[model samples]
Structures are given as structure tokens and as C-alpha cells.
Target: MPQIPPPQQQVTHVNPQTLEELPAPVMQQIQPITPGQVRSARSAMEDMSAAAKTSPLTPIPRISSQTVSLSAGASIPQVRVFPNQATTVTFSDATGHPWVLGAPPYNSSPCATGGELCVGYIPGSAVFTIQPTNAYASGNITVLLKGLATPVIINVKGAEPSVKSKTVDVDYRLDLRIPKRSPDTPVYTATPEKKISLYDKQLQSVLDGIPPEDAQRLKLKNAPGSTKVWQIGDELYVRSNMQLQDEFEKTLSAIDGTHVYVLPATPVLTFSVNGQARDVEVELN
Candidate 1:
């Protein structure tokens, strides 16, 4: 009985390679991922990543996409003010809204030098006054409006209260008059030629009578090509093409007591407006 002990139970072992070759179980269905879900998941992941990177003590930088610019308008009219005199400047916004005075800060060059130019603004009114110290205190007063690219320029001129006065003597003997030509003088005839020759001789005589000093004072020599002597009514006009210097009037006044005739000429003052040279007529009193 011992020798015939029960047959041992048979045992079998499968190789790992054989189990790996076996087919996987088939799944019945699966949920399809939509594009919206993918996007949401990706956004959530990005937000989480950003939150992790940022600290509570750190400040996030902000960026702006729009640009701002100042308003541009027509050039303001040139302001002319006599020294020690005051004038107001009023301006409106691009939308026609008047600017509040003193709201936009203003600055002036050579500021508050006691005798220098002074600029003051009146609150609640869109006006600013500019004043100089005296007639002799003359210079450019530039008023800059904050946030404005262009400045309001005021030309301060020294207008003296007193003007030199002198008597001007005229010689009626040198009066240029057009003689009445005889109607009997026929055109294209010897009579007309003789009349023209006589007129030329008379003109030469009148010219010769003008003294050399008088000619020099009148600036007749080296005068421009456009210079002309015109006789209008009882007055004589000597027009010179070039601008006369300031001393020209003084010279004429010095020659007042003489036989030479003097005709009043318009006086011009040359100045700069925003770096551009300009001429303005000045009345002499």
C-alpha cells in the first residue's frame, strides 16, 4: 500500500510569453471628448499653471493698447502789445469748449524779473493778461499752455510816448507840373518832336536845380529800379522800392530847414513772428 501511494496530482505551468500573446478584452463603448471640453481642460490647466507661478506679494503688469495724443488747431493770431500794456488771450478746446483759466498751468520765459514781462490768468475765465514793466522793457513773451504743443507768442514792442517833431520846408520852385500841350501839335509831326524836346529840357533843368545834398538825403542815388517820383494833386510822392532804415526819419528831420521839399513816407517796422520776419506799418505822431 505504501508503494502504491496515490498518484501525485498533475501540475501544469503556463509561460509568461503565452499569456502576453493573448487578445485583450473588447470594451462596449467609450465617451468621445469634444473640442470644447479639450479647450476648457487646456484653459483650466493654463490658469492653474499661472496661479502657481504668481505669488501674493507680486504685482501683475498691465498693458494698454490705445494711444493718446494732444489736440492741434489753427495758429493763433499774432498778438501785438506795447510795453507796460496788458492784453488778454482767449482760447477754446477742439470741441469748442472754453478752457478754464489757470486750469492749464502756464509758464513764461525770463519769469518774474520784477521789471520783466509778467503773465497772469483769471480763474473761471479763459483769459490771460500779459504786461511788461515799461515802454523800454521789450522782448518776446512766450506763454506755454500745459499739454499743448504750440505756444501763444506775444510780441512786446517798445512804443515810446514821445516822438520827435520838426518842421518840413518845401520849395515850390521845384514843383513838377505837366504842361498843357497845344492841341494844334499834330502827332507824327515835327511840332510834337519839338514839344517833347522842350519838355525834356525843362525836366533836366529841374533835376539840375536839386542840390547834391538833397539828392543824397532823398536817397535818389542808388535807388531801386522801381523807385519813382509821383505828383498827385498838390502833394509829391517819392516811393523807394527798398525798405528804409530807422535813421532815415532822423536824417529828414535834420534837413527840415532848407530849400529842399520833404514828402512824408510811410514808416515800416520789421519784426519776427514765430521766427518768420514780417513788416508792419507804424504811425508817427
Candidate 2:
């Protein structure tokens, strides 16, 4: 009875299986990686930083030549200022040559190669900047031309230190011009001629022309024979051609001090006192 019940429920239904099989999934293509890209970028950044550190330095320079020409009157010529460091400096000049600015050693401080020249500039202050390139004493400096012979005055404002520090500002400039030669030039000088003019009548007449005030101004002394004493001044004493400003000075070793005062203004003598040699305050009797 159990087997008959199972055979009665054996009905099977099969549907159409018409679905297409899907293609195998393909893997995504990956890009090839280049080597050292990160390292190159790091190296580039390092170079940029290094460039930023070294480019703005300026050092002081020495003056190679200096000249003053009287032909140009008071006008200053173009003077070149060089820096002692390896940095670049900007300067200016618009006038003639006499105003050409040059820098010298600052005070007691010596100017060394690859170092600062001095300090302080009034005209162009904002153009100054310090950098590592100025660590040395030689560098290219630019002087900008603003106006002419307006007296480009530059001074060293900072003190030079024995030890290097970033605090000091080194600057120096020159005010120069050709010195004019005076019109009254000494043309002829008397040479050492062994001729004595003491007894000459013409020389005595010439000597008589000298005022008593002039003779007193010279502190001329009268003495017997050739030996004479000329009391010149408290500090200065002259014997013959020798002049002495100090009592202990050995320059007048040949002159013996007799302290004799002379009358009349005579240029003839073996030795004579020159200049305002006496401080006599005499009252009239």
C-alpha cells in the first residue's frame, strides 16, 4: 500500500534552459611605475633651498686707484667702489668725478677679503640686504647713479666685531674732488751758499727795513761774535736752521742755550730765533 501511494505522485516538469553563458571576467590593465620619481622631487627641493640661501650676499672691496686733478676744478670724477666680499652691491653716481664714492677701512678695523667694508648710507638705505655670499671680502657691487655732485656721503654705522655676527651693517663711501693748486707758488728756494751777508752794507740796509715789531716777533737775540742766544718760545727753540718744540728734544743738540735777547731785525747771524718766541708783557715806565 505504501509503494502504490509513491507511484501516484511521480509527475516531473522540465522547462527550456535557453540562457547564454557569460564570458570570463577580464582583469584591469595596470600602469607601469617609474623609478626614483620621489627621490628626484626631493633633490629638486633641496637645490631650490640652497639657491635661496646663497644669492644675496655682498662683500667690501679695496680702492685700487685715487687721483685728484686740478684741471676739473672742484668736480669729482667717477670713482669705482669695490666690495671685499663675494656679494653684489648696488650704488649710484650722477654727478662729476669728485663725488665718486669709494670706501676705506672702517676705523681701527682692517678691511679683509670677503668681508664687509663699513656701514651707514643715507641716500639709498632700502637697497641694502645681507646674505651669505658676503661672507668673503670680494664681491661685485653696483653703485646706482641718482644725482650729480650732491655729495654722496656714506659712513660706517656699525662697529666691526672681532668675531663674525649678522648684526653689523658694513658701509663706506667717499667724498672726493681735485684739490686746486694755489696761485702763489714758491718758485725759488735759497740754496745753501757759504756766503756771509752779516757785514754787507746792502744786507744791513735791507735788515734795517724790518720793523721792531717784526724783530720782537722773531725773538732775535744779540750776542758777541758768532755765538748768540735766541730765546724763541716756551716750547719751541730754533738755532740755525734747526727748530725744536720740546726742551728734551735731541734735534737741537748742536744749539747751546744762552737765552740772549737781540735788538733790531737782522736776518744775518749764525743762528736766529724764528716765530713768536717771547711772551714779554712789559709796562711803560
Q: Indicate which candidate wins on lDDT.
A: 1
Off by over 4 Å in 1: 1-77, 93-97, 101-111, 144-147, 159-285
CA error at residue 87 for candidate 1, angstroms:
1.8
- TM-score for all models, in order of appearance: 0.25, 0.20
Tens-place lDDT digits, model 2, residues 1-285:
555545557666655576464443421223133348767878899999999765343434322112233342443333233234322233311111122223321222223443444433344232233222233432323333233232222222222332454333333332222222112313331211122222233222222232222122333445232332222223222223322222222221111221222232234333324552432222111
TM-score of predicted model 1? 0.25
Best by TM-score: 1
lDDT of 1 by residue, 1-285 (tens): 467778889888888777653333322123256679989999999999999765323212211110112235533223334443455555433211243433633444344655565667666654566555543455665544434444555445433332343221111111111122222223342122222222233233323333222232222333333333433233333333233322221111000111112244544433333455445443332
Error of 1 at 51 (Å): 86
Q: Distance from true position, residue 172, model 2, in Å?
A: 7.5
- Give stretches of model 2 more than 4 Å off: 1-36, 48-60, 70-76, 81-285
